[model samples]
Each structure stands twice: as C-alpha cells, then as structure tokens.
Target: MSDALVTHQDIALRLAIPLEKAHEPRVNTLIQDSEELIQDAFAEVGRDYRLEVANLLQRRAIIRVIREMVATAVIVGPYSGARSVNSSSGPNSDGLTWDKVPEVSFAGVKLTDAHRRALGLVVGNDFAPSWNFPPATRWPLRGGDN
Candidate 1:
C-alpha cells in the first residue's frame, strides 16, 4: 500500500535507517492517527456502501503490512482465511458461524499501539488467530502461553 510505503519510507529517511530495517515502532504513531482519520471520514458519510469501502481499504492495508514485515521480525500465525459461503444460506449471509474457520492467535508479542498500528497498516481490523512467531523471552512483552 502506498500509504504504508510512504510512512515506512519517511521513518527510514528521518532515522537514517534502511528502508527495509528502520525501527517502525516510532514512526507508526502518525500512521495510526491518520487511519483513525479515515474511520472518522466514514462516520460522516450517509451511505453504507461508502463506509464499507473505507473499511475494506483499511483491512487490505493491515493485511499488506503484516504480510510484508512478519518474516524477519517474528510473527505468530498460520491463520485461516474466511471460510466458504454456505449455499443453503442466502447470498448475504455471514457464512457459517463455524467455530473453527479463522485460526487467529497472538503471533508473538502483542504489539504496542505503535506496533499495532504498524501491523494494522498491514492487516486492517481483521481478526487473526494464533501467531507462530518464535518465542522472545528477551522482548519486554511476552504472549501468555509462557
């Protein structure tokens, strides 16, 4: 996403860190605020279609950011995508309320607001079950499974 790339690059330039390796926790602060702005924009709109569009874009952005950075930094997920729709249900149905469709969990350290926004820039607000990131006893934050 251009928004994420631009934000990531800005941090890289200001910190004199490589574009690929800049410390993101610091820069993502501004990004999170901007995303909140987008949400606010949706709130002002009168149409459901317009609001849903914004929500889709935000989710895509979150997915992109997480997919890109998770390899090196450690992340936790082998999460499932949304399940197939049920033919019996009407086309507008929310698919099966199946108990085990999406497999999200904490991927590693629960990201701080800084990191969470950064990750959100990747995955939006979509829930993800379970993250398979390597254990980080050294990281100040730890997932509860320990």
Candidate 2:
C-alpha cells in the first residue's frame, strides 16, 4: 500500500518467510491494515505520528515498533480472538499450548503499552513526578502542643 510503513520485503525478512509468500495479496493487505491500526493508536494518545516521529531519532524507534506490530498482525492472521490454543496427542500424551496476553496482543495488530512508549505516547508513569517536597512546616505551638 502507498502509506504502508513496512514493506513485504521487510516482513519477509523479519519473519524469515519466503519473499514470494510475503508478496501474496493477504500479506500486502495486512501490511496496509496494520499501518492504519498504528495510526489510530497514535491518534488515541493524541499524537500525530507523522509530526511527532519525523525526527531521525524518533523515526528509528517508531519504525521498529511499527514493524513488529505489523508482523504480529500478519502472524496472527484473522483468527486473533483466540487467546490460547492447546493440542494434545492422547490422554497421557504430550501437549503443546500457546498463550497470549490481551495487552500485548491486538489479536491482529493492536497497540501494546511498549509500542506506545516507543512512540513517546503517554502511558502510566511516563509523566509521573519524582520531586520530593519538603515536609510541611508545623504551625507554632498555638495550642501548647495539644
């Protein structure tokens, strides 16, 4: 897509998928979709991605986050609603399970707290003040220390 932040090549290299697979229509579509989701996330935090991440330093950081977001969407595909999957061979056989945390998984391409931080979006404690105020001065013993 014209405004896609990551290209098929980038996705392919990141996921170690065949370049041909990355060029498929599904992957291409996911690339554009992921970027749109990212833009929405930026807007949610009142940050204009194009404006705030234009600097060289910010660009590198934001791009890495964006790429990971897109890769996740592509990897998760359309079946993002399932939080966990369990497979077992038999009653007492080996089993494999995969689990995902909601905050970290967009189910497809959702923005994670880490992503917001990398983009400089405000999250808990990002703006927390650390200054220690001096103890309040006690009033003179007006009541004789009552």
lDDT of each: 0.41, 0.67
- What is the per-residue lDDT of model 2 for residues 96-119, given as tens digits with 9 covering 90 to 100? 455554433443566777887777
lDDT of 1 by residue, 1-146 (tens): 46343364543444422544444653364445444544443354432424444576655654344333332122212332324445545555454433442223233212333434543323344467567777877757677856
Best by lDDT: 2
- Number of the top TM-score candidate: 2
- In model 1, what is the error at residue 98, expressed in angstroms? 58
Q: Return the lDDT, model 1, position 95.
A: 46
Task: Give candidate 1's TM-score.
Answer: 0.23
Off by over 4 Å in 2: 1-3, 17-23, 76-100, 103-107, 129-146
What TM-score does each of the candidates earn?
0.23, 0.61
